[model samples]
Target: MRPDLLLHRWSSSSVVILLGFAELNFPFISSLHIHVELLRGFCSDNPRNQQYPSARIKALERKMQKLGEFKLPHFFNYPPYFTLQPVRDTREKQIQLWKELILDYCKSQKTFVIAIEEEFPLFTNHVIERSLTHEAKETFLSALVSEGRAEWMDKGHRRCLILWHRIQDWADILIQFAKDNGLEDGVVTIEEIRSGPESQGTELHGIDRTILNRALKLLEQKGKLVVFKGTSTDDEGVKFSI
Candidate 1:
């Protein structure tokens, strides 16, 4: 049998194979089930064969290790996912995946802020040598902002404030924390609610002051809390009404 026909016959094998042929019109095999060493030997003598897949696989493995606790979906390893898909349905799914991955990464890392020009781990894949462009970054962030899961920090759009929990949800959490600590109708400094002993180890601890203020304002509008600024700007306080 001719080598081309033999290759076509072996293409259905489960093993991954990278074959390079000089003839562009040849009916080449898309996959192979043969041993990798055998395939390597077949291509070893061919000067035109390009070794691309192994390096790509190695890079992907490195990226997986860098993910830490963030679990990447299977499609994340697919190279096409790094580009903006042109098809409507495929692009929709791609955008959705980007949104989910961004939110998950932020929540896992406790990342409340994302600066556009800054180096963010989630925005780059060192393994695939792929990274989201500025437009792609804005598209994903804007989707989250539309859903109230994030906000633009400034008019220049250089930064974003990620809210894994909506402002209303944070308000509810704050109220629950106050009630649990017997602070209902009691006063606490804004700073205390953020880093005081009472807030330590709780979801309220280390909360962003801007987010906290927004949550408090939401509650205040609903008569659930009162925010009063002391004479000193640093002495702002909140009084919960249960």
Candidate 2:
């Protein structure tokens, strides 16, 4: 058989095998299991194997270690990972995975920003020479936008602000900081958090000014914090109540 034909045959059989698992009616676990088995089959069937199933499983296992919920391992050198589907159920799962992966990658790397044309390490697989096309990247990120977990950084989505940690998380961080640092009843300049030595090297270090402001505003709406201005936008301070 031609190498291409052999691979194609293997892929088709794997899909059938995956569907067999998916067809099992065992509730939540069935879907999860199906996804896992599908990944297993996909990895195992690769002709490049020197160690067969063990090597494939180990490779995927390592890839998945870096990802969080709904996120798959970085090993999706396969082309299917990039395509957004019209199939309702599959699309939902794929979207969920993309959201989780994007968030995980951003949070761990402290990537607060994502650009459409830029090469996101999360979106590329040099091991297989595959990268997300612009449309695919937008599709995944737009899913986040719809769910209130992401936003476009501009009129065009060429630039995006990824809220992997979310505004609520940012608010929680502020609340915790307030409680920990005895700022609950006191006030300090926003610049102090954004640039002062106090926040340096912490998660707050070098945070984008806009994200900091948004997080503060979220806290303000809850009446847990108040923002007051003194000299400039950078000099704004917050007073937290309890």
Per candidate, the number of residue pairs that clash is 1, 0
| lDDT (Cα, tens digit) per residue for candidate 1, span 54-161 | 554344445654487677654443345566666676567677777888888887777889999899987776554678888888878888898889999999889999
> What's model 1's lDDT at 209?
83
Which residue runs of candidate 2 sit more than 4 Å off their true CA positions?
1-75, 200-202
Query: Would you list the C-alpha lDDT of every candidate in the order shown?
Result: 0.70, 0.68
Q: Return the number of clashes found in candidate 2.
A: 0
- Would you give me the overall lDDT of model 1? 0.70
- Candidate 2 lDDT, 1-242, residue by residue in tens: 77534444555435533443343222143343334455454444555532336665566445644433334543243445556656777667766767887887787777888989987777875433457788889899999999888899888889988887778888888788778778879887888887777776677766777788899998888898899987878777878886
Residue pairs with colliding backbones in model 1 are 13-33
The best candidate in terms of lDDT = 1
Candidate whose TM-score is highest = 1
